[model samples]
Target: MAEEQEGSDAGSEEVLLTPAQLIRSLEQAWMNEKFAPELLESKSEVVECVVEQLEHMEENLKRAKGGDLKVSIHRMEVERIRYVLSSYLRCRLRKIEKFFPHVLEKEKTRAEGDPSILSPEEFAFAKEYMANTETHFRNVALKHMPPNLQKVDLLKAVTKPNLDSFVFLRVKERQENILVEPETDEQREYVIDLDEDSQHLIRYKTIAPLVASGAVQLI
Candidate 1:
């Protein structure tokens, strides 16, 4: 019985990810989803896998002794990695919310035609997680009023193409207007508002390439 109890405890032990390992895992997940979102499987799995690691890091931070320079530096490094992980996940969540809205189903088994982007194990974990926390995707992500997005969020959004979506940008270089209509004002500049930093409102596709080349920045 003692041996069996020890085995059970061992099986339940959590795996801790090193700060570097967690950053790499999160970044890889983000890049894969960024390039081929449709092909990327188990979106939440990618994020959820690091939850324990994040928690462990947080626990260490909470108890960390102060005044030691080494400890202070290490804590900042951990915090930076934590921020990266969070920003990566937030971007992915925004993509999921915009593109794959079906996975958040709290009611009814996952609907047809919406592929289980998560593996069977991951799906099971998510179902259990949501039930335990009473959380939906919106609650985790889209809830509450508008607030300042992290710097990375703005950077990622501008670089990615979201057709039919409106975005704010500052034009550093000029490109031919593809949306020009016949008899329209020739060389008419497009300005959404009076703000000098953000004067253009254009479809994402029109400016995506330019933004990728540092010709524009999302405001």
Candidate 2:
């Protein structure tokens, strides 16, 4: 019988998923976040589940012989998972630091029932980052400026992600009628069907919705 792992969705519904499936989800989320130009929605559930698994494995390892080959293998596996988890989080933090103002604005203005793009902890980090950034700006340059020019608009100052940038991705689900924009005046926009398991190099903006819906995976 297949083992069941406890998990939850954004809607707070409890779901059963295998450990392997959970890791695959994390890997997909990591890759998508790594390649996407802009920040994507938070996968806190997967992160938490993976962290919990790591803790359980560490606890089990504590009971095993230190030099056992099986122990060593498990240790290495744990390390690999930790690396992926850390890298995923670091990628997100880098994006958050790069675009904290816009991130905060999005969080603030999102509809009441909509899911948040940042986890609660990430939200806190973004707010703190914004505060420190503004303080640094004021002390380093804004304070020295004439009163009329002292005010700064962070949204205008910080550059947003280039949605038009090209990204490599593999289709996870068959999608029909994806619109591809023209490159030049002579070229015309056209629609194309994306077959499942097919890979393509395309503009991020053109398939961003697919990425959000898990219909495509960034390669």
Candidate 3:
């Protein structure tokens, strides 16, 4: 069929940064950003790679402009690439937002506890970028949005009375000398164990520091 030949012809032409490659690139970017928290003074190399390939893809798209089917197919593929990029950045943004306090205090803090991980340079960049991003989210993304849609930025969302609930947590790090609520005046108890999970009737504020320090996680 003529359509089949057209498809074959288009497929024969080399395309830049296929969807799989783009997805992989984004994943690598996320990993680098996460694991190399101390070296984060540099922008993500993965993001740079993706943007370069994206530009190449855009050029190809321009060349394929006359072919409706080719353009359509390429558009769909491009959308996929954009989605991966957006999802990667948003995920990073969410983590950064959640740990904004840690970022402020320590350049490289663990997901659970107070020991620092980021170098001075990485911390400065992260803190500045996060502050700007949060401002943008507040001023643009969440500003004047519908009431129901307003809670999309969960990090900045105001707590509702019904929103509080009992949670299960798994301990992942040790916190020394933490004061426990009950058992009267013993004052300091090594309250948690590594890899031990427990359920508690508590508020977010009660465990927020633990969660921030990578000492505990909701399970």
Give the alpha carbon lDDT tens digit for every residue of 73-108 in model 3. 888888878776776566556555555554454443
Which window of ten consecutive residues has the lowest lDDT sum in model 3?
1-10
TM-scores vs. true structure, each candidate: 0.37, 0.91, 0.38
Which stretches of model 2 miss by more than 4 angstroms?
A: 1-12
In model 3, the clashing pairs are 108-117, 108-118, 111-214, 112-213, 112-214, 112-215, 113-213, 113-214
Candidate 3 overall lDDT versus native: 0.52
Residue 118, model 1: Cα distance from true site in angstroms: 4.8
- Measured with C-alpha atoms, the lDDT of residue 181 in candidate 2 is 99
Instruction: Quote the positional error of residue 190 for candidate 3 in Å.
Output: 22
At residue 73, give the lDDT of candidate 2: 96
Whole-model lDDT values for every prediction? 0.50, 0.89, 0.52
Could you tell me which 10 consecutive residues in candidate 1 have the lowest summed lDDT? 1-10
Clashes of each: 1, 0, 8
Better lDDT candidate (2, 3): 2
Residue 172's lDDT in candidate 2? 87
Q: Higher-lDDT candidate among 1 and 2? A: 2
